[model samples]
Target: MLRHEFQPGRLVAGLVFAAAGTVYAGDAAGLWDTPWFVIVPLVVGGLCLAGATATVTRGIRRRSGKKRLGRSTLDG
Candidate 1:
């Protein structure tokens, strides 16, 4: 049995933030240059995409759950 439900939205968001952090780290380390305002859109877009993905995933799960419930009722 699984201990907890997996959250893909959080995973995507984490990856996005990690990428941004990596960019900043690179800049700090003098490996590359990152503009001060570059993070604004990166974070905002990532969050929006993650939210959309979560909504879609939830809808799909709910639909599948309803189908399973219906089948169980019919079989019993």
Candidate 2:
């Protein structure tokens, strides 16, 4: 069986979008007092930004600790 890949970026973005949808749904039904437009972008964009930053940092750190191609530790 093939295993599913776990993606933190997609997960965080998806959760943010889902939450934004819920906020709109609640507002439409008069269950929420907050304005819809302001909160949705803030929530979604912030989470996406955080997710991107984390993904980039993780990649950078991983590469920084690894030996480069065409080079060996003994050559240093």
Candidate maximizing TM-score: 1
Residue lDDT tens for model 2, 1-76: 9998466666677777777778778888999676647775768686877688678867976787575633666577
**lDDT values of the candidates?**
0.94, 0.73
lDDT of 2 at 58: 79
Q: Which ten residues in a row have the lowest lDDT in candidate 1?
A: 1-10
Best by lDDT: 1
Query: How far does residue 3 in candidate 2 sit from its true spot (Å)?
Result: 0.7
Tens-digit lDDT track for model 1 on 1-76?
A: 7699888889889999998999899999999989999999999999998998899889999999999999999999
Which clashing pairs does model 2 show?
none
RMSD of candidates 1 onward, in order: 1.5, 4.3
Query: Candidate 2, after superposition: displacement of residue 6 in Å?
Result: 1.1
How far in Å is the alpha carbon of 65 misplaced in model 2? Answer: 9.2
Clashes of each: 0, 0
TM-score of each candidate? 0.94, 0.56
